[model samples]
Target: MPGRLQHKAALITGAGSGIGLESSLLFASEGANVLLIDVNVQAAEKVQKLIAERYPNVKSAAIKADVSKESDIKAAVDKAVELFGRLDVMFNNAGIMHPEDDNALNTEERIWDLTMNINLKGVWWGCKYAILAMRNNPTDASKGLHTGGSIINTASFVAIMGAATPQLAYTASKGAVLAMTRELAMVHAREGIRLNSICPGPLKTPLLMDFLNTTEKRERRMVHLPMGRFGEAIEIAQGALFLASDESSYITGTDFAVDGGLSSCYVTATGEPTLPPPSSLA
Candidate 1:
């Protein structure tokens, strides 16, 4: 018996914590050789240790990588292939929220640039190098691994729906993520490389907790949520797993929303267990 990602190699950025950490662990459970990349070296090592303890049967590595930096990205990718012999997947999950609360009108030039560099440009770099490395892999006839591989990007539901909050820089960066996914999907579709974005809704991750600690802010945020609760990192990891595995062979240039129905819900649609029938009396 073989696993869903048996014999495959995966390089996941932001794998130090939250959704990235959950994804790296889940991928290993499914038989992927995971390379955990993070800007925080200690956190990455911590996750790597946890993986080793839990999944002794699978191979895993950790590398400190600032995804916004090209040299760091290159070194991490190179390290993965050097240790694993091939690259089959790239999960570009590293991203940041703007340090300031800047809307389009008042958004600081520096903040916008920083957000775009990390969120958008980082994915572009990951796809560029991952595609190159995957193309060079030797085809394994046994598992029908003749094709290159897949790329999963961490986008946001805000990319589709305008922010119910105040972060413009994050919105713009994630919008670029959706666009990049589509364009990259088309560009390398011929190469058998699939690229898609995982647009997560509000999650109970430390990143979110750090931003919305106040009771007022947290309550305000929770009201808009149809599910009335934040999602878990593991829930989003399952979405990434679907995209990373052969399961999504036909999926590309798409935004897979793992937002607990947040992206698809409308304000008026709330509290309705079912839709009303067509009004014949109207």
Candidate 2:
């Protein structure tokens, strides 16, 4: 049998590491031609080479692009179309959590602007161009490929729930992403397009790990996790895969939380999880 995303084209931002890297590999494994976009050209190229070797039948390429720059986003989307003939999935997953980002009084204007530029504005540009490209996607009924595509923005659990340890700008930016995704999903509901934000809890990725560097910092958030463990990047990738594929055809405009019950918990249980975290493919 063919893979879930066989013959589909996907463009992923921040493909160098963390959730983006895992998603790129997973998407390729499922037979989607992938365009990996990242500021780190070397990292993106490494993933592209791995995809070429592992999933030889699927086309994969890497491009150096900063998600904060609109032109770069447009170029990446256009490249996906040029390579795969259409864009079926756009994962606007690139974002940052500045170490300096803290409470309103402590966070600097530069930090705020930088976080918003990449986290919020970058997602906006990705959605804007992806929609334009997806609008003209060539339909192929036999393969289940359609004109409209799915867009997944990486939001955070903090967007929906408040965090005592504040990364104010990061939280605010993600909240905006959730809102933007909802409105866009509504606007394009009739156009066969789908938009949804995937909200992830604290993960063992480099991004969050760096921020929670000290043991005190780590424990501060750990006390609240019902699972008693940080999530893996691959876990979020699985959620992105479902949203990208037709399996989630009925889902759109929703805040799909892949959090480990973090958002829903009032008081976390005290034990560690028996099940092991999902292993990374990258």
**Top-scoring candidate (lDDT):** 2
Q: On residues 70-184, what C-alpha lDDT tens digit does candidate 2 reach at each position?
A: 9999999999999999999999999999999999899999999999999999999999999999999999898888899999999999999977588999999999999999999
- Residues 36-107 of candidate 1 have per-residue lDDT tens digits of 999898999998898898888888989888888888888888998898888999999999875474677888
Candidate 2 scores a C-alpha RMSD against the true structure in Å of 0.8
- Model 2: runs farther than 4 Å from truth? none
Per-candidate TM vs. native?
0.92, 0.98
Q: Each model's number of backbone clashes?
A: 0, 0
How big is the positional error of residue 26 in model 2, measured in Å on the Cα after superposition? 0.2
What is the lDDT for 275 in model 1? 26
Question: What is the Cα-based TM-score of model 2?
Answer: 0.98
